[model samples]
Target chain A: MSYKLQFAELLPYWNVLLQGLIFTIVLTVVSTVAGIAVGTAGASARTFGPVWLGRIVAVYVELIRNTPFIVQLFFIFFGLPALGLKLSETTAAFLAMVINLGAYSTEIIRAGIEAVPKGHIEAGLSLAMTKWEVLRRIVLNQAFRKIYPALSSQIIIVMLGSAVVSQISAEDLTYAANFVASRNFRNFEVYLLAALAYLVLAMLTRSLLRALGRVIFKAR
Target chain B: MLQFSFWDILSNLLIATQWTIVLSLIAFVCGGIVGLALLFMRTSRIPALEWFTKVYIEFFQGTPLLMQLFLFFFGIALFGFEVSPWTAATLALTFWTSAFLTEVWRGCVESIPKGQWEASSSLALSYIEQMRYVILPQASRIAVAPTVGFSVQVIKGTALASIIGFVELTKAGTMLNNATFRPFLVYSLVALIYFCLCFPLSWWAKKIEGRLNVAR
Candidate 1:
């Protein structure tokens, strides 16, 4: 092979790469929080809300789950403008990630919620807790404990999937690699670095999530 | 300027959908073969092979598929070989799918009782013999539903091939949208087509999973 790896050529673009890495982390963190919140709410509604509402949530989950993330991003970024709901590239990417993770986490959290025994809710209610309190204190707490590992995995998946955001010019880590590759014409080196960065990010995200889970679940 | 009727868009997308299906099948089949090899290495008693398989799965699972696609797409070209997007996408998706499938299948294999391995070895069966005759047969039963479930992911993974300039469903949708300036309609149809292709498989996986749980 005549081609030599030119990773050293990428050194000048370290700041660009750093900015992209930070942006990607920012995207992952924001989307993870908002997505899990949406998931928890959706799960609660499905488990306790009216039949019609449950059906609506089910349809939302199925539609999101069945299609690929890039399609959904395209629909939001390019398609939504037709409906007079134009958003900035970053906003569109963030929205897409939140919506995508929201759907999957809704299903994951729902599984946890359903596994919560009826006796636990009854016990909380008998202790003079309101329905909201029972759900918040007993149902969700136990459900989160049961599904924390699955939920954590989903969060990491979403973080990794955030690479697609670069397609819409959202300037995530993959975008940094693309930008640097275009500048230096070192596509292989740039992508290799970016991939390694992503591997590290995924590991960090996993560990952070595990620490957060430990803190939240307490006494685990 | 050329005009596109709704039927025209649908028909074009339908044509492109065939490539998506073909590409997915290739990736899944090739990945399954490689993943099976990895699964054996994972289950093998040799520390070196097991450790290598573990790192392989971790690297593939941890990195983004888009990045992997880019690596394959560009990495091959750098080696003084003329690389087509088809080869790149196929190779990337295959490795990506193999990583995930190996992990999924590993869980199923591990879920088999330890006593089965002990009893098989007590019968003087070789590792290959045990896996081929006894272990795989049982693990595969538990593996079927999840394997089918992962195919939805394989289909979805192929969409990233569009980014590398493979003219599959998503790429076709982009071209049509550019031509027609009807992003909402084109992308919606694109998403609908994917849902159609994927929903049935997921439904079947779920149904099989439910039956498995009931059986257990």
Candidate 2:
């Protein structure tokens, strides 16, 4: 099957594509930070909180982890207004993302938290550190470093997952792809190009995360 | 002013749940076949074949399933071939699902000790024989938890097909919400249906993972 490549015709859409990319990157960064914060809290709850708290964490993690993210997105984008809380489309999309990311991040962080050596916590305690200080300075620091690579991979996954936001018309890269495909009548070529763009974006994200890791955990 | 009614929406919402299950099952089964082929290709000694498989996985993994659906459902039609949204949805998801499942299964396959592969080969077992009698049986155990876990991804992924007019759970919910004008109450039911379908699988996957870790 002979297929024509139309890379040149796509040049005019570069600005739009660039805008979409910027939007995606920003959403990813915001969600990643929020996800980490929520995930860290969830993980800590599961690891050290009381039995009831752990059970609540388990329910949240399991529900989010099992379901398709798009389903979760739709639930938030479409479901919540029935409860008398109405958010704008982009707000719904962004909030859905944070919730979804938070769940997956929770499990990943929990694993890291669990892997923290007990002896290290004891050593910190011996140094007269308060319990909270020991956990923050010793346990969490080691856990974050250990899970840096896993967390980086998860962030990329979240970045890619952000494409679902297009359903709510948030104008991200996938939404832009839909626009280009619709206008240019080059569905295959447009999507193929979009796929390539996503690949480049993921590679860039992975590298950026690694750079962030290097600065944050200079000991590595 | 989308006034929400509880039981009115709940009744129809229950039916949408079935479509989600159907789509997930279809995608998972189709992906397994494609995944197995890709796994075999990865293990092949041919460098080009291996590179092709790698590229295939990376492409699917890197892109969101949403774009792939648009490309397949709309892209094919642009080339003068009419594709049903259902077909496009299935094809795109099957392709995407294969990538992740193959990578997951391949890891399980390769993680089997090298000595076992060598032992089977030294015993004059052909490649297929070695895989069937020695390698695969053990790898099957490792593959189970991850493969089951990956199915949740497939189930989740089917939701993307709703954009192309496939009336799965999310699509149904979208339409219902438009008509009923009660997005929140309608969608919470949708989310609950999805949670019902996915949670058990997630639990089973974790149960297996814990056991696998213990075995290791």
Candidate 3:
């Protein structure tokens, strides 16, 4: 069967594609911010909180890390409604991405925190610096510097994972791709374009994170 | 109200869990085979072959698996080949798995000291002999834990197969939710089963790494 490739068919839907890309980026940015907050808090809880709290954080980390992100998204999107806690598709997707990234980053940040020398904390104590001040001024920044690479990779993984949110009609990049494909019956071309878009997004995200890292960490 | 008894939901989910396991296994085995070959090509000194394999890994790793599954599901059918959900999931996942495993194995192989390769070469070992007798033996020790850890990822990945209509755990949960309207129970049960399947593997991988670290 001779088939001609038709990239022209999708030309009209370029705005939808652009909107989808924006939503995808919006989700990633929101989730990255929320996830880092959740992760830093969880990491500190696991590292320096009371034993019981640490154990609870441990369980949360394991549960999130072990299961699939898509399952977690489904649970939030579908399951929560049953519990009378209704969330929009976009909200559910954002919550799931943050939760997923938070769990993984907890571990990453924990590793970085552990790598901080015990003497550093003792020195802060000897200087009469409150524990919170030490953590804020010294430990947290150093931990962020140390684990920035792993943390960025996890963020990218979550970005790629945002594609699954399309399954629930979240109107992300993949959702728009699906919309255009179903409309034009150009499944192959549409998906091929979607794949390329994701590839470019991944590369762009990596470089952006790397540059961001340089600015934030202020190191070579 | 369509009454799906608690037992009814449990049994249906238990059955669907089997497909999840099956798809993960297929992807793991097939991806391992393909990944090993890719690893060799990437590690080889041939510039063209190395470049080709590097590009292959990046393409597969950089793109999302959901897109790959969609392409295989509909792309093959466009060429007049009837693509079952099972076949499409497995094919895309295998490629996805190979890309990651190749990179993982390369890290292990490269972790071997530079002097080891020089010493083996000076001792008149051929490239193949050196790999078999020297490099592989050392690298396999490092590779085993990560490879098993990666199985959890492979299992979780099979969940996406449901998007294309593969009746895995996630798919089963969605279907049962539709039928029973007990989304909370169905999905909670589904997530629990995944945790059960994946947690032990992750725990084992960590345990192995702990032991290896102590040994090192």
Candidate 4:
């Protein structure tokens, strides 16, 4: 009971922690963009592509969604090197995040696409719009609007899940915390600080995504 | 050099899988009880209790489950308790699971019309009586599908426990990979085993959800 919290012990390592935080943010941003692009393409393929293509996407989604992200990270980081496809820890981590988020967002976006009324697409088609134009102008805008909130939540989940990338020495925020904790032997304080940082990051990411949504949708 | 046959690896992993299942069940059951308590506090119409529950949920939901595990793993040692990874994993996953389940169940409870509550109260039923007799029954029917769905999350969350040196399936996979030096084969098997454990639950949840939607 006499153990006093020594958060100040971690102060000297603030630069390291800050670097990790920025790296994590970079990871989140890059993964969010790439992941959503992949998801959109996957969703479109599932909804509009050939039967074989749709089945391929379905299998990919199911395989990723059912397994844990950490396992996926391990598979990419460790398993792939055996196949002569070696990647840096950071690249592997980023790939895992993108693939993980892509699967979840694919499902979310697919639901939104399916929710778009058939009548609306037909209306767009009758307006002299080609299939691609109708899908781009009419289908996706509304679908993204419907699923933006869920998509935002999944993005944040991926951001938080990025903590595990440290297990492979990716040197993200959690890795920084572990480094500091090891140096100072203040495991409790360092982890407490890191957890609070993550809480703040999650909140900030949530609001930022909300603001982005408002700008994109422009519908209240 | 010790050679581990494929069966040797598979048999060891299957054993470790039991701990993963056990840990998940403990987290789900304990978290359910705690989450139900939080659900009541959140909906109890008391401002302070409601606010406290809100902060509790926000803290757990906002942070990573891995951070929570580290906190529990190292945080307990500060209290002079010789904490095993099992206890830390259980405590951390329980709190994490409770936060999510409370949110899920809160939606279910709130979806019940206010008229149900008013009607129960008008019949001279107490708050607990109303919840027990009327609200929970209705809410639980809607809650079942999502609750089952969330169990997959609980199971996956246990994978992080491996990082803290818990001898669960993921940890065993890592150990076996080191022993066998076949990361591709080992991790693939690990992921496949998890998929086998989880996919059925995910499918069942979707099926139940579909049935509920049809019933509605």
- The candidate that wins on DockQ is 1
Q: List DockQ for all candidates.
A: 0.91, 0.56, 0.86, 0.90
For model 3 chain B, give the 10-residue run with minimal summed lDDT.
B1-10
Shares of reference contacts reproduced by the candidates, in order, are 0.94, 0.74, 0.86, 0.88
Query: What do the candidate models score in CA lDDT, each in turn?
Result: 0.95, 0.84, 0.93, 0.95
By lDDT, is 1 or 4 better? 1
How would you class the docking of model 2? Answer: medium
lDDT of 2 by residue, B122-209 (tens): 9999887888899889999899999988887787888778888998888888888888876666677777877787788878998999
Question: CA lDDT of B84 in candidate 1?
Answer: 92
The regions of model 1 sitting more than 4 angstroms off are none
TM-score of chain B of each: 0.99, 0.94, 0.97, 0.99
Worst 10 residues of 4 chain A by lDDT: A211-220
Q: Over 4 Å off in model 2, which ranges?
A: A1-7, A82-84, A214-220, B1-8
DockQ of candidate 4 (2 decimals):
0.90
User: Pairs clashing in candidate 2?
Assistant: A68-B156, A78-B183, A79-B184, A79-B187, A80-B184, A81-B184, A82-B184, A82-B185
Query: Could you arrange the candidates by DockQ from highest to lowest?
Result: 1, 4, 3, 2
Prediction-by-prediction clash tally: 0, 8, 0, 0
